[model samples]
Target: MTETESKARVAKFHIGQVVKHRIFPFRGVIFDIDPVFNNTEEWWLSIPAEVRPRKDQPFYHLYAENAETEYVAYVSEQNLLADTSPEPIRHPQVREMFVRIEGGAYRPRDLRVN
Candidate 1:
């Protein structure tokens, strides 16, 4: 993270809260927090990483959910808007099912008889 990047993550918010990327218009639950490097500055949030435009800067990247797609986005910290609305946490079993499916442990099979 660059000197400016480090100084851009201090926010007036806490983790596990809901936030929205103002530029991308995507919303997600806060996963991580970043400290400011310089003066009292903005805070960073971990946007769920995606396959495109991969970068190492945390303040410039964010994870958000659009419908069913979970993608990573690169946006400035100033562009991140705090969402005060409470969001329901994902059920453990449901999350496990998704993991299984994504890991290829759960595959669809053809059951039609010839």
Candidate 2:
């Protein structure tokens, strides 16, 4: 196998892990992870070129919170860090998707769609 093909892409964060932006003042819980950029070009272009993340890395979908309010955010893996705070997330939507928090991880309610 080629060198690049042999290197598996490992997601650093899991579906229920809590995380915060490396350069932003907000935190969130991971709702989903994409192996690489899966958003629209319009959305990607919104970020300034100098700081924009590469498309080859993992991207996360989050139930996010700031000092003022809660919302959703799409963030690149390079920009995220694990949130070690023991306190549970307060986003209202969290309850709809996650059943509980156990050992600092959110437990997603299984909603299988065929």
How high is the CA lDDT of each candidate model?
Answer: 0.44, 0.89
Model 2 scores a C-alpha lDDT of 0.89
- Highest-scoring model, lDDT: 2
lDDT of 1 by residue, 10-99 (tens): 465444345676656477544445543221222222344442222222343334576557764434455567765455324232232222
TM for candidate 2 is: 0.86
lDDT for model 1 comes to 0.44
Root-mean-square deviation (CA) per prediction = 13.3, 3.1
C-alpha positional error of residue 28 in candidate 1 after TM-score superposition, expressed in Å: 0.6
Q: Which residue segments of model 1 deviate by more than 4 Å?
A: 1-9, 36-63, 73-75, 85-114
Q: TM-score for all predictions?
A: 0.41, 0.86
